[model samples]
Structure formats: C-alpha cells, structure tokens
Target chain A: MKKLINLQPSKPVRVLLGLLPFIILLLLYIGASDARLADNPNDKLLPSLNSFVEAIDRMAFTADKRSGGYLFWQDSYSSLKRLFTGVGISAALALSLGVLMGAIPFFRAKLSPLVTAISLIPPMAILPILFIIFGLGEFSKVVLIVIGIAPFITRDVLQRVQEIPSEQIIKAQTLGANTWQIILRVILPQIMPRLLAAVRLSLGAAWLFLIAAEAIAATDGLGYRIFLVRRYLSMDVILPYVAWITLLAFIIDYLIRLASAKLYPWFHSQEN
Target chain B: MSYLNIQNLWKEYGDQIVLEQINNKVEKGDFVTIVGASGCGKTTFLKMLLGTETPSRGQILLDGQPIASEPNEERGIVFQRYSVFPHMTVLENVMLSRELESSPILGRLFGKQKKQAAEDAKQMIELVGLSHALNKYPHELSGGMQQRLALAQSLIKKPRILLLDEPFGALDPGIRTDMHQLVLKLWKEHQLTIFMITHDIKEGFFLGTRLWVFDKDRFDPQAPNAYGAKITYDLPVGDIDKETYQQIDQSLTPSEPEIAEAS
Candidate 1:
C-alpha cells in the first residue's frame, strides 16, 4: 500500500482534482438558489441564474439614457485606466530609485530610511488629506494608488538589488565598467524581472487603493457603480460586478506572470 | 623593478588587524598560490591585490606605478561563486567586458566592433572548452562548466593580473583535476601573472610556481585580535616531499575537536 504523502497523481487526475472544489461550490449555489426562488420568486438575497444574466444585460448591453454610453464598459475603462497608470508610474519609480538606492551606498544611506518610513504609513489614513489637497479628482485617485504601492515596490526592488551577489558587481568593475555603465548593463537587466515580480505582488494592494479612491470620490468607475446599486438592494447586479472585477484582476495577474516568465526564462530557471 | 611589488602592506578594520606586514615582489608570469586556515585574511590579501580592498598602510606597485585604488581592466578575478553574470549567455558573458570598455556609456558594441568582440569571445570560450554552451545561461551550466564560463569571462579582458579565490573549492575531485589542467594551459599560453588562494594545500603545490603560507607567529591569550596573519612561508615550488606536505597540512588544520569530529 502506498503512503498518502508519497502518492502522486497523474496529469488528468491533477486537473480534475484542481476543479473539484469549484464544482462542488457551484452545485451547492445552484441548489440553494433554486430552493430560495421556489420559496419566494422575488427573493433578491439568493437570485437565480436567470436573474444574474438579466442584471448583466441591463448593465452591459443597455445604454444609459442620460449619457448614451454603456455603464459597465465605461466603468471598466475608467478603473483599468487609473489602475494601469498608477501601477506604471510606480514601476518606473521603483526601477530608478530602487536601483540607485541599492547599488550606491550614498543614495542608500540617504533614502532607505525615508522609504522605509513611508512604506510603514497606512495609505488609507491619508486618504482624507489627499482628497483635501487634490480635491477628489482623477489625479488624487491615481496619486492615492501610487502613494499606496510605490514605496512598497521601491523597497522590494531595493531588496532584490541588494540580493544580487557582490561578486557580479566586482566582476563588472574589473571589466572596466564605470558606475553608469554598471547600472545600465549589469544591474538594470537583472532588476527588471524583480521589478515585475514586485509589481505583481503589489497589484492586490494597488486594486484596493484604486477601488477605495474611486468609491470615495469618483462619479464613474466599477466601485462607484457597485456602491450606486447598493441602495436598491441589487444583489443580482452586485454579484456579477464583483465576479467581473475578480475575473479582470485574475486575467491581469496571469498576463503579468506570463510576460515575466516569457521574457526572463533565465530568472525562472534559477528560481526552480 | 619587479613586475609587481607589495611594500609593507597592512590592512586593518578599525583595531582588528586582518593582514599585517606583507612584503613581496612578483614577476610578470609567476603563479603564486596562497594557503591558510579559514578567516586568516587570505581573501583580504587577494582583494587588496585586485584593488577592491585598499590596504590601510603601504602600497602596491605594478610595473613601477601604484596600482589603482579601484578595480580596473588591468586586473581580473574569479570567485568560487557568482563570477559569471546570471542573466547572460556564455558568449555574452565573455563579450561583456569588451563591450563595456569600447562603448563606455551604452555598454554595448555595434556593427564591426560587435562582430570582432563576438569573434574574440568565441575564441576565448573555445579555450575554456565551453563552445557548445555558447547560448546557455549560467543557471543551465553545471558547476564546473559555470566556472569555465567564469574563466572565459575574465580572460576575455586579457588582464595583466588574474586572481582566483578558491575557484575550485566547490567542484568534484575529477572536475577539479580537469580544471587544474585547463588553468595551467591557459596560464602558459597567456603568460599571465596569477594569484590563487586555496583551502587545499595539494592544489596550491600542484598549480603554483611559488607557494605562500599565511599564519601568525604571535598569539595573545587575553585578546585574540591583538595580532594578524602574515606570509610566514614563501617557498619556490620545485619538489616537495610527502612529509613536508603532511607537516604543512597538520599545521594549517585548526586544533578544534568539534571540527575534527564534524569532518
């Protein structure tokens, strides 16, 4: 008899095993939803599958009478725009500042403490101040996301840069590389994959900051729409919106991971 | 003047002395192997020679000029690990020094220069017996192959001085023997001045034209840091008997019962 810990599954069995929990959850949800609808056809607490499809159609397919635009698509566009912009700026800042701080002792001594202190602050605590200063505009929302994640990414990148063996740096010096040359050739390529990884880790926090900012200040966005529909007790609409947001986040995470693995096979190999 | 001169060199970190009162002159093509117990400042001595760690006192002169305070193209080093850039393929690893030197700001070469550098790097890779792995990254190469790649990376620069810090300390015995032959062939072919530090006394004897033993002649029971190591034995390596080898080996081994038991 094989021991449980030592037992291994074949490829098809592994795939089926991965899907087991989701399948169980789906069946359970369908049974509860059917029972609730039988008891009260108008029950919004556990809406039927038909109700979900109807809500999605109303939000996505129907054009708003006031603005002549699809609310779902518009909200998605605004949210994604803010998310990418904030994360992009943060990535750029992390690459430059992090590499400088990690590679040069002078910069490290000067900036590392400041970065550590900044990263320690709760970003949400400063949301009110950001609203006061930037006046609840898109800029403030974007700035909120940047301030939320930039310090963390910068610190992560700094650690990765510091983790690079000193021998590589010394070897570069002996190869006649000046400081600028070393940064460009030796440090930048190595730091880039690490930067991607940092960004991926920070995406969850980035999204949280984005939704919070949008909920507090924005007239249009995924978070705004969800909050707007809350007053009507629109569980059908809210559930789908939440699922859509989760799906989007999953796709973005997947894409970033795929890009990293594709571009830096060497890094992935070292990791394994 | 000697090809290289170390005059009254001393390296200290605060009050703790690492290396003290080191003085020697090395010819252009001399292969000097150094052996010492762990933490006896053998690496510190090598770092000083490579111009990474400056001596607290005295000076080192190469061909009648003081060696630069920082590492330069005139000196190359291969550490036990991380001697090759992980991100680069074998060819790129060997060609990087040339690219950085020629282009300076961009750290890249183009057109005619790029072609010439690739050619030179390929030849160097061939010399190190890594031609088949030209496109392979450091992670993909075996330990011995990676060290070979590291050698190619350093030798591509054609440095005046080559420093090896326990370059084969982590290899299998069979691979180490193969590497020893490769290093000897490269040394003669390049006519290079080399300084190698090893934990293995046998390796020191087999590879070096001259061997240096770093040990302190004085010890204080109250304060261990009161003294530092110096070149206690500098011998020309012509023929060494088994008894002499055993004596040096016994002397270098630490007198700790725990270490002996662990080994």
Candidate 2:
C-alpha cells in the first residue's frame, strides 16, 4: 500500500477540516442504525414520529404569539437579556468602586479591613442575608452579583496601579506633570488594560453568580428552567438548555477576548 | 562664580557611601559628561542633581545659590528609557513644560492654552526630525524615535540646565552616533548647559566639553557617604581638537601609585 499522508488543517482551511469528522461519524451512525430500523417490529413508530414532528411544526409556526415558550432557544433569549442587565449593572458598579479604591490610597487603606472581611465570605454564603435585605427579587440578584464581583475588581485595579512602571511616574514629574496629571494621564493608561481584563473576568464570575442567584430564588431563568427539567427528569429539555447556556457563555467569552485583543495588543506580546 | 557647583558632595544608602567629598564646577553653556564603569553611581549622581534622590552630605549651588530639595523648574532630565507617556502624542509631551509655565491657572480649568507652547513643540519636533510623527503616540515609534521624543520633551522645558542619565545608551551604534551628532547640534543651537552620564568612553569624549573620570574604589558601600565605588583617579578630559593636550594631560594625570594613595 502507498504511504498515507496526514494533513493538518490550518486556520483558513478549518471549515473543510471540521466537516470531515462530522461527515464520517454521520455515515457510520446511519449505517449502524439502518439494520436496527428495518429489524424493528413496530408500525406504532409512525404515530410517535408524527407527534414529534407535529409538535415541532406547531411551535415553529406559532412561535410569535406563544412568546416563544415552546422554543427553548427563544426562551434563552429572554434569559440572556435579563443576564445582560444584571451583568451591566454589576460591571459598572464594580468598575466605579475599583477605580475609586485604586485611585485613593487612604480610602483603600481605610476600607481594607471591611473589604477583606466581605470578600473572604463568598456571596453564596450570605443568601439569607440578601433575601432579608433585598427580598427574592431582581434587587437580590443584582446585590448577589455586585458582592461577588466588586472585591476582585478593586484588587485587580489596585495591583495594576501599583505595578505601573515607576520610571514613567518619575518621568512625568520631571516633565512638570502635577499629581493629577500623573494619575489621569500616565497612570490611567497603564492600568486600563489590566482593569479591562479584570472586568472581563468579573463578567464570567457574574454570569455564574446570576445562575446561582436564580437557583436560590427565581421562577424564570435558564437556570430555573434547567431546575424544572431535572425535577421532571426531562433530560431532553435539560440537554438543549445546557447546550444553549454553554454556547452563549462561549460567545460571551469570545467577544470579551476579541475586545481585549483589540484594545491591548501588547498583552499578546507580553505572553511570549 | 560658577554656573553650578558641587562642593563636598556626599551620598549614602543606609551605611553605604556612594559619593564623598566630590567637588566640581560647571560654567554656563558647557557640555559636561561623566563616564564610569557599572555600579559607579553615575546615575545616582544624576538623580541627586535632579533632586530625585538626596545627598547624604554636601550641597549643590546653582547660579551661586544653594539648591534646597528639588526646584520647581530649573533642570530638565532625560533617561535611558523612553519615558515619554505612551498615551500622549509627541506634541503633548514636548509642550508639557511650557504648559506648566504659561497656564498655571488654565491647567486648573483643563484648558489647552499655550499657542506659543504648541509652536515651540512643533519646532522641537522638527529639530528632532519627527515632524511627520508629531501626532503619534510614543508606543507607535521605534526605540530610537521614542528616545528622541523623550529628548524633545526634556529640551522643550528650556530649563537652564539639562541632565541626561545615559540617554543614548539604549540605541544601536549607528543611531547612537546620530544621536551624539544631534545632541551636538541641539547644544549649539540652543546654547543650553548640558550635564550627562554615559558608560561609553568614546561618546563621553565626543560630546563632553569637559569629562570627569570617576574613580571606582572611592565608592565605599560600607561608608556613610561613599564617593561612588572608590573613584581611584580623576582626569580632567581636555577640550576638543586638543588630542596633543589630552596626551600631555594623560601623562600628567596621576600614576597608579599616586592614584591609590589619593583614593
């Protein structure tokens, strides 16, 4: 036999490469199942298949009026919208607090004990406290996210501010930059990439927290829906919802990475 | 009176003495370069002058007045690294000092108020041959270009004296030569007093109107005020076009036996 050539797919040719494995698996699966289908003694399979197709077709056609309840994927959109609101608020509050703490050493020092205490206890531990304070509403969810995310953001920005090259600060002083100029101009730019990285990391944390928050006290989120499926042992619904969550998280993470790469190309160079 | 004088200068880090009983005088518009081996406190001395660091003993008198701590705007300094702000464009870096001088109040208002400052920045950018990249960020430039941007930032301040700490040491040989020539041209054009430190002996000889050979052993790390690793000798490098004078001075310069005793 002639020697076989093993070809590695490159980035540009990845689509074609990806299809190869799928096609092979599909053919093998169909070939193996073909005998089983013919061997089946049930003409009753027609009724079940008809019911499955009918349900799918009805949902596909009437998806608009039902508020997309039948389409699990459409329900995920509402969940996503709610998650976005939670995340946006969390990020803004955390970023503001982070910048404030990072900029003022006195404030950071004064708040050190309290911040340490709060951050040491995971937000999940204080579910009862959040329930008491904000109730089992959106307020509780937002509080859960902010508490989970703020300390990490503050520490990240603080470290970045501290790690800013002293030479740059000294140089700015020599150039006659006042304290404010040094902070706003020289120090700010240096810390921005790290701060952004912290925000991206916080977003992922917030996403996880949102699910946890919904699980603690909520009726309508992806996590809630997943919980509902588990109670009924409906793995079909659970499986699709799980896949949807995974895909959504992947897209969010990818978008964040893309933003980071665009904003901070120097980070890639630093890795090497 | 000397334009600036370093009399009985001393510096120490904890128990270690880096500079001790050093005396030197510089005239207005003179280009002075100090060269030494590594860890010889060349940068330490420059920092002391810039008031970034304090001398353990002794005083520096500028224009016959003793300098107290750091002056607001009398001296400009450039460093080996491109200390230009990566966020700001080249023009902004050069105009910073002028902005400080002209708009003491405008800065409070966050107003960009220096028409003359902008003009001066443009001229300095052109002087550095960076007219085309005036609006570019420091990170956009090559290392040499960034250093030139840094140089422009320093010179535009128009301080009575310029202090450079091995500003061109980071450049390649060809770019170093170019920078050396550029420094000469800028010195001549501006008639600015320049004091610089460098490890390159030839570079010292090329630009320095007067060069100081800092003796190595004199820097006593244990002493409270060490004079930079025991500068074993001092040589008054003669003026340019005086190679024969340098030869004569070299012979007159203390021999090893005398240097050891003095050190």
Candidate 3:
C-alpha cells in the first residue's frame, strides 16, 4: 500500500491532476455566483467580457497598449520585482545573521535574549521609530523589515544548531577536522533542513511585514496599490493584488521545498 | 619499556574517586580488552588513554614520552553510534581525515592532495569490504556497514593506537561476531595496538589477547567494605578452546549485593 502511494504520476496524469482543481473551482464559482447575476447582464458583463478577450489577443501578439491593460501589466511586473527583491534582501540578511549567531555559542547566548525581546515588540510599533530614524524613505522600509524578520530567523536557526547531535561534532573532531571543516561539512549539512524550514516560515512573515512597511512608509509597490484601492473601496483591484501575493508566496515556498528535497534526499525518505 | 605505559594513574571527580592507582603496560601490537559491569570505570580508562580526560594522580607515556593534554592523530577512536559522519559518503568521510593530517593551504585550495586522498580512501574502503558503499551516506547503510565505514576511517590515518568503546553493542550477535573478525583481521594486518572497552563477557574473552576486568565497589560484592576498592584480573589468552571459555563463564560468581566474594 505504501509502495502504491509512492508511485510518481505520469506527465499526462500530473497535467490532468493539476488542471482538475481549476476546472472544479471555475465550475463552482460560475454555478454559485450565477444566481446573483444582475438583471442588465449585458450592461454589467459586455465591456469586461470584450476587454478580457481583447487583452488575451493583445498578449498573444505584441506589446501594443490597446485599452491601457499594458499599464496594469507594467505595474504588476515592477511590483513583483520590488516584492521579490525586498524579500530576498530581508531573507539574506536574516540568514546571514542567523547562521552567524547559530554557529558561535558565545554570540548565541549573549545575543539571543536581546533578539527575543526585540522580536516581541510589535512590528507595527516600529514604523514611527523607523520613519523618525530613516526619514520616510526606502531605507526605513527595508530596515524595518530586516529588524522584524532577522530575530525569528536567528532564534529558529540557533535552536536548530543546538539541536544537532553532539556526536556528529565529536565524530568529525576524532577524524581530525578543524573548527572550520566541522562547520562546513558536518554542521552545515545537519542544519540545512532546519535552515530551509526556517526560511520557508520567515518568507511569510517577511511578506506580511513588507506590505505593512510599504503601505505605511512608501509607494509604488503592491502593498501601496492595495492600500490605495482600499481607500476608494475598489474591492476588485484589492482582491486581485491579494490573490497575486498569495499565489507568488505559494510558488516560492513550493520551489524552495522542492530544492530542499532534491538536495537532501535522505530527509524525504525519512519523512515517509 | 612498554610501548604504552601508565605511571601510578589516579582519577577522581571532586571528592569521589573513579580510578585509584591504575598501573598497566601494553606492548606493541597487543590486543587489550577491558571488561566490567556498568560504572566500573572501564570507559574512564579508555578516555585517559585517548587523553580526552585526565588522571588526577599519574601520567601516561606513549613511546616512552608523556601524552599531551589533547587528542592527536596517533589515537583513532570509534564511538558507539557516531563514528561516521552521517551526511558525507563513506569515501568522503575516510578521505577527510587524511586531508586534515596532510594537506597544505595551496593543496587544500586546489584540492590536489584531497583528490589523491580520495583514491587512497577508496582503496581502504575496498579493504574493509565497503567499496560498493563508497558513495552511500551513513544513514543509507546498515548498522554493520556503518561500523565498517567507521573502522575504515579510523584505519585510514594509520593511527598507532585504535580505541573502541563498545562499538558493536548495537549490532546483533551474528553481525557482532563478523565485525570482531573483521577488526582482528585489520589489526593483524596493520599490527595495530587495540584498547577496547566492553561489558559483554563473551566479547571481552573472545577478542582480547589479554583481558582486564574492573570490579568497582558499587557492583562488587561488599559495597561498604569495598568502597573505593577494585580488583583486577589478567586472564591469559593462549590456545584457548570453547570448553575452557565456558568453564571460565561458569566458574565465577559475579558480585551480588548481599553476597560478598573474595578476589
């Protein structure tokens, strides 16, 4: 029975399986929302229907700006780039500090309590201080995020490093490994799984902070656009941006997990 | 002078004494096994030999010189479950020890000597009957196989003394016997001096050319009287037969709490 469950889906089977959800959801939404359809159905649907088909046609052919859909695409692309860069910078800073704190015992002991204290202070509490310090710029937003995300990363990784079996370190030492060798070969491999998990968790926190940071402190990001739409009560625009963020987060998390499984096949087998 | 000698060795933990007046000698290529019930300080004896722990009373001399304060390349140790690096392949683990001992800065950067050490590691793996598992991680291998890899890594450095702390306690009886034979074969071929600690009487009797038993006061017959006391046995192993081993097992009464036996 376990063996049967482990069998990989064929290409066509996987494709069909992937499409099955969208198909089901599409049918459900159409069926469920159809009852509330407006009496002037043509008036409500005709322009959007025509615009959707035209947008698809334009996308299929060229970069022609027919009906200002080009503006939406451009804004989304720039927003995506900004979001990913923001996430990457914060994650990188967090991971570096995390690994550094995790590997050094004295640093871990001395710094961890301060980190815990800082992490408990609400992220929302930091905006005014950040604005006062960095004066309402990108620096304030990025710095706010780095401060918010790095402690969780450090705490998770420090705990993980401590949890690695002491036997592994002793084994390497008996084999004549130096401190650096032990870290690179033995400690790093053991912590990679924990590190990956920490990153996956922090990615969500970082995203939350990013939107909050952008919405309050700056402009020209998805968070700002969402906040702007909310002001006008533009639920459609707001909902779509939320959907995009959710989809992107899901994709990034999935990709990282896939990479982890590939790099550490031993973990996946144990997971079963 | 003996190849390895301890001079009036004494070990104590604060007010409690662990080992008192331990004086022993091991010749070149000798297989010495220490056997005792739990908490007999057999492990402490090995730790002193490895220089991992200190004896408060005396000094250890290897090759007629005092052993240093830290562990060195001359003593290779095999732990119970953690002898091999779990993440690295068998080949990588074996080669890494050699690289640590020999590689220079430029050689390490270029990985030149490491490459050569890898080939040598492959040869050692073949010697240990694990060539097929050269690329497998420790977790992917069986317990017996992992122990075999541990042996390979220990031997790869060609250390003068091989210290084992009940390395086969986790293996089944049959696999344990196989590992014993494999270890003896490698030891004989390399003329390696072995100091192993085990609680298994059969294993102690079977492997050691000379067996020393630790009779701690806790496990000894008379607790209050035998407190801070010990008895050592030097059982000669020469042309021993199965019946003789059985006789040795049957003749002795172990120290039970209420029943005190004289040494």
Candidate 4:
C-alpha cells in the first residue's frame, strides 16, 4: 500500500498517463486500417481513414437522396431523446421508491424482495414481451430501457438511502415532519446527487437496453441504422456510428458528473 | 402536576425491565442532567421524554395531557453524532423546519415570511456562535462547531423540550466547557426544559439545575430483570446545604433523598 501511494505522480502527468491507452488504441487501429487498405482497397472489414471520413461527410453533411433528411442528426436526436426519457423515468421511480423502501418499514418489506426478484430476471428475456405488449414502436423501446435499468437504479438508490443515518430522519421528525415531510424535506435533497450517480451507473445498462430495443425494432435511430446496413456489411457506417455513440455517451456522462459535483459537492466528496 | 410528568413509568423488553417504578417531574426552564452507569437506560429515559419510545406501563404527561405517540416539534433531540444534516449549510439546517413547516410544494414562504424565517434562522445561528459558519457544511466544521450548529437547528424550532444524548462527549475539554456555558445561556434565554444524558458525573452535576443518579435498586444474581433502575438520587444542585450533605453521607447511600424540590 505504501509503495502504491509513493508511486503516485503529480496530477497533470497522471492525467497524461491515463490518456496513453486511448492513444495506443488509436495508433494501432490506424496501422491496421493502413495495412488492410494496402492489401485491398475495397476491404469492408478494416476500411481506410478516407472511407470513414467520406462516410461521416455523407451521413452528416449530405442529405439522404431518398429520405432528404440528415440521417446522422436525426438519429442522434431520436436516440438522445429516448435515452434521457428512459433514464429520467427510471431516476424518478427509483428515487421515490428507493426512499420509501429505505426510510419506511412497510415499503421496505413490501418492495425489497419484489425489486430484487425483478432485477435478477434478465432484461433481454423480457424484451419480446415488451414489444408484444407495447408494440414494435418507440414506446416499447423506452419501456425496455426502463425495465432493463430502473430496477438496478432503484436497488442502488435504496442501498444509498439505507446508508443515511437514522438520526437525520429522526431529527426531521422532531422538526414537525410527518412521513411525507420526512420524505420530501429530509430524504429527497440528501439523495438527489446520489440518484444522479445511480443513474450514471445504470447508464451502461440503459444504453444496452436502448440499442437492443432499437436494433430489433425501430423506424429511425442510431442502433436501427447500424443494424439496417449490416446486410451489406457496411463496416464504414457501423464503425463511425459506434464511435458517434461512444462520443455522445461520454459527453452525457461527463455533463452529469460535472452537474453533480457543482450542485451537490457534499455528495461528491461523500463518494470518496 | 408539573409542566412535564413521568408517572410510574416502567419500560421493559419481553423479560428484562430497564426502568421500573420511575416517577419524576420536570418544571419549565429546568436544566436536568442525568448520570448513570452504562446499560442503566439513561438514554432510554430521555427518548421517552421525546416520545420516540413509550413505556410499557404508565404515561408521560405534558401540561396535564398525555404526550403524543410520535415525535413532533414540541420536542427536539441532539445526538453526539449525526445531529446536523450533512447536506445543508448551518443556516439552512437551522431554517429547514421553518421552510418545511411552511409550505409543502415549494417549501417557500411568500416575500415577507421568507425574509422573516431567514432572519430568525440567522439570529439563532448567531446565538449558537456560528455566525462565521452559516454557509459551511457540517463536515467542514469542527466537532464543536457541528454541535453548535445542531444546537442552533433545534433551538430554531423553539421546542418545548430539548433532549440531548452525550452532546458534548465528543468535543475537546475546552470546547466542552464552552458548550456547557452556551447550554446554560440557551436554557435561560429560551426557557427550555432540557433533559440531558451524560456518562460523565462531573458534567452531569456542573451543568444541571437538577442532577439524577440512575442505577438499579436490587441486583439479583439469577434474576436481574426482576428489578430495574429507579432514580436513586435526585438532587437539586445549588440548593442543598451542609446539613443535607451530612444527612446524605449518614444514609447508606445518596439514593435516599432527604429532600427533593417539587417540580
């Protein structure tokens, strides 16, 4: 432990070290793409940088000749809307239900086992059921994301709420708080950033559910586009789409982190 | 009948009685400090006063009426730890009850009332000597400062009874002494009925208008639950004379109070 502690360098150098892996991956990918293109100019497996750039330009800059709509922006907007909506509904349900389970005995007894059971069931297993019930449309996709991720978020929020000292609740009670007041006044604000964190953790599952739902059945979405072009083995479009999704996810995650740190710094430090 | 009365209060878990045949009355503005050996149910007694726990037998009456079953604004509590909310600033912690009790939706009072609550909370923070720290979080404050914030939060509620469990036990000796003086001042200024449980004998005696030593009456080797602790000694500090001390010394123990001031 002492050796590990002593090995730490200053912040800037450490941050640079953290980026080395990404740089190495990029260099390796460029070399592989260059070698594959040299062997065959029309290789779909590892398309050249020119292919990627042309793919981006066509999807982003030029409107599809038939659809006459910018596919990249349209797909981005639809996917982002679904992601936030699913995560938003999940966060709301998780916060309310989690606090109820954590702070109240009746709720804890009633919902704890049920939530645990629901979370244990594979979300993908229920995907067909959701499509059948909600139909193969946007609602089904959003519901899939919620069902896939809400339980985990709910469980995480419940655990965090339980970690709060009982004394804090009792203090609120002594301050004229009834059950609702205790939930709203005492528990809600304290758990806000923590719920954000729970959402952040559930993001991976959220994205998985979203992509699966979209890939299987959707009219217009990033996941749908990737799957749509798979028949032709369009690695160019697929790779760029995957990179775009990664960039969007990274941006959203970074924003949530920044908001949590700025708005509720106490919860941020409490994380450590 | 006094402002607060515990009449024949007995508390027990299935087979073991913690307190039995307890009778005490606390008057308004009384700073009552209780001392007892560990596991003697001193904290339980204070909890009963807060209505967080109820006795198996008998009842606690406030102003001739039985106290409510659940905790309310009438009674406030401060534990040594977790007394202050970690999320709120000191002033916000003090203002929370005011804000919460006002409106359910926004927790906001209209123009003047909001200003009024802010002003009152500010004054309360100053009263606890935390004016410099109204904007700081609980973790940023020292142990003593956190306690001061806790005290301020409770005092802002203007509770009829203040229950403290080892409030100063975590503070340094110097801070503890300062806290002692602050408590006395608050008690006088607010006319609060304070019931404090302390492990330290000296602190119990030094800060209280009335001091109670709690321990069991009869300890049976085989059947300990048969009897539980009562108020072995209830002394009104600063009132007992030399003769009373000699009388207490002559007795087998101070448990037999020669005199007790009626609450």
Please provide, for model 3 over B138-198, each residue's C-alpha lDDT reduced to its tens digit, 9 standing for 90 to 100. Answer: 8889999999999999898888889998999999889998999999999899999998887
Q: What value of lDDT does candidate 1 attain over all alpha carbons?
A: 0.92
The 10-residue segment with the lowest total lDDT in model 4 chain A: A1-10
Models ranked on TM-score: 1, 4, 3, 2
lDDT of each: 0.92, 0.71, 0.73, 0.86
Best by lDDT: 1
List the candidate 2 regions with Cα displacement exceeding 4 Å. Answer: A1-8, A18-120, A257-272, B63-73, B95-119, B216-236, B239-263
Q: Chain B, TM-score, each prediction?
A: 0.94, 0.82, 0.87, 0.89
Task: Give a tens-digit lDDT track for model 3, residues A110-187.
Answer: 877788898898877878988898897767767666677767776787777776666566666666766676676767
Give the higher-lDDT candidate: 1 or 4.
1
User: Model 1 misses residue B239 by how many Å?
Assistant: 3.4
Tens-place lDDT per residue, model 2, A1-272, is 43457655578689878788989976775564455456772422222333345544553345646365555555576568767776666556655555556666786788756767778888888878999988888788877877887777766776677666666767766667676665666666566677667777777678788888777677677777767656756443555566668888888878877887777665544544
Q: In CAPRI terms, where does candidate 2 land? A: acceptable
Q: What is the lDDT of residue B34 in candidate 1?
A: 98
Q: Which residue pairs in candidate 1 have backbone atoms (N, alpha carbon, C) closer than 3 angstroms, thus clashing?
A: none
Candidate 4, superposed: residue stretches over 4 Å from native: A1-5, A270-272, B239-263
Question: Which is superior by TM-score, 2 or 3?
Answer: 3
Interface RMSD of each: 0.7, 3.6, 2.9, 1.4
- Model 1: DockQ score: 0.88
Best prediction by TM-score:
1
lDDT of 3 at B157: 84
**lDDT tens string, model 1, A182-252?**
89998999988899989999999999999898888899999988888889889998999899999999999
Q: List TM-score (chain A only) for every prediction.
A: 0.97, 0.72, 0.74, 0.93
